[model samples]
Target: MSATSDAYRIEPVTPAVKDYLRLRQQAGLSPFSEEAATRGLAGSIFGVSLMQGAEIVGMGRIIGDGGCFYQVTDIAVLPEHQGRGLGKRIMSALADYMQAHLPATAYVSLIADVPANRLYQQFGFVETAPRSLGMAMKIGAPESL
Candidate 1:
């Protein structure tokens, strides 16, 4: 692992379709078929992946219309490398990108995975209950309810 506090680098995902699929699978963060990732890679309004040497140790993505709203999605960190605050690094990068580029009240958001919600809150995310409820429509299990 070439990742250190100093060497960690994050940039918007490139055409590294293979690396994205591999790490997302290893992290148990829902595997994307190679073609799906390649397609969605282009669909991303914004995204970031943490690279150390040739390995993608952390990743996150944003999906939405670029101008008015966005949803932060697909956040993952390799299991072997968890608990080092790498997810924070990923989120920080994403948040910075949002803050620098989005307009006032642009409404960036994400569906946090429990404890990960804490990390997001530090970066100005919050739970909105009465305002709205979060819902999902699993692609394969359309009638999952």
Candidate 2:
């Protein structure tokens, strides 16, 4: 479906903190506490919300320092809203933002999950595995060390 079909519209506004958290959870992403989510949402460089009337059904955001680095994160669509190409629409908006605002030398990255990686690849995201693997450690979580 088109990005702005009769059923939905993509708004170039960050989802409210409540909607952000709800979308993340409903879309099967890891949960974040309200305090953490509030701080994180405030730091979004750019974000979009997929709206169906008054309700937010999907979202995506880019976060990083304004110049050298950025990460496409929090891409999520409601389960009932999946299979409608909304994810591609969300990424298209993000790609447009990156092209228009980010520097040519800037490094944009995202940690794609499973089949969603295919969607990201269409946007020119390549696997960095074998050269530099992605790694992470949650704060306050038990460390391997």
Candidate 3:
């Protein structure tokens, strides 16, 4: 949906556990087990979803220790809805939340994957390289269930 269209709306609500898993997968993100999602999402500080009627077509979340550290993550928009500015809508809501709720000195960060990093730049996110880099490792079994 277009940004000016009334057909789409962004809501300050955490997605259902199933929707979280599904949206991430559909958006080509890493897979999370039901157990992992249940535990992880329960700790979310804030989240928002883009809805076209009742369907959640996009999502973004801030998940981290609520005090000194916060990470902007879980950004995903369904493949069919990618180019209509939905990702920006999700980030706009997240940015608004951070601006309103976060402490002045809170450390906010995000790991932007390739092309998506460009969209993040519009929201004032800058790259931190030659000093610190984003890193990750998969836990548990080698194969996903």
Candidate 4:
């Protein structure tokens, strides 16, 4: 198959739950158990898949309370398919969805790893540091939650 970025078609569909998990694992993101993945994906507000002839080459998802909070997560493209601008394609779809669907008072956010964070800036995502920092804790861990 051609490795060109434009070769893939981005579709508005929930990817298979297993594909979602595998893509994340392949992309070096944290793993989610089968039950957790199933439940989490079931609650996604919207998702997009970059398809190469019925195969999910890439994917992204939006999750959160529909009205007030939304997060862009699980942005993953297969390693063999990386660097063809698929990440931008994924975020573009998500940004369009937010513009059309989100309430004006709603907050949209993402925790971008370095370098990937630069791509997100084009979509107007600003860092939330120096005023209020982003923080998190694993559930049930001894550390403060």
Winning model by lDDT: 2
Q: List the candidates ranked by TM-score, beginning with the highest.
A: 2, 4, 3, 1
Model 2 CA deviation exceeding 4 Å by range:
1-5, 142-145
Model 2 local distance difference test score: 0.93
Cα lDDT tens digits, model 1, 5-78, are: 56667877743788788777888776667878888888887778887767677788878887888998878888
Prediction-by-prediction clash tally: 0, 0, 0, 0
lDDT of 3 by residue, 1-145 (tens): 2444367899999899999999999998988899999999999999998898889988999998898999999999898877878788899999999999999899899999899999999998899897888876578855552
Per-model CA lDDT versus the true structure: 0.80, 0.93, 0.89, 0.89
Task: Give the 10-residue window scoring lowest on summed lDDT in candidate 2.
Answer: 1-10
lDDT of 4: 0.89
Off by over 4 Å in 1: 1-3, 143-145
Candidate 1 local distance difference test against the native? 0.80
Give the per-residue lDDT digits (tens) of candidate 4, residues 7-93.
Answer: 788999878878988888998888778888899989999999999887998899999999999999999998899988889999999
lDDT at 105, model 1: 77
* CA RMSD per model (angstroms): 2.2, 2.9, 2.5, 2.0
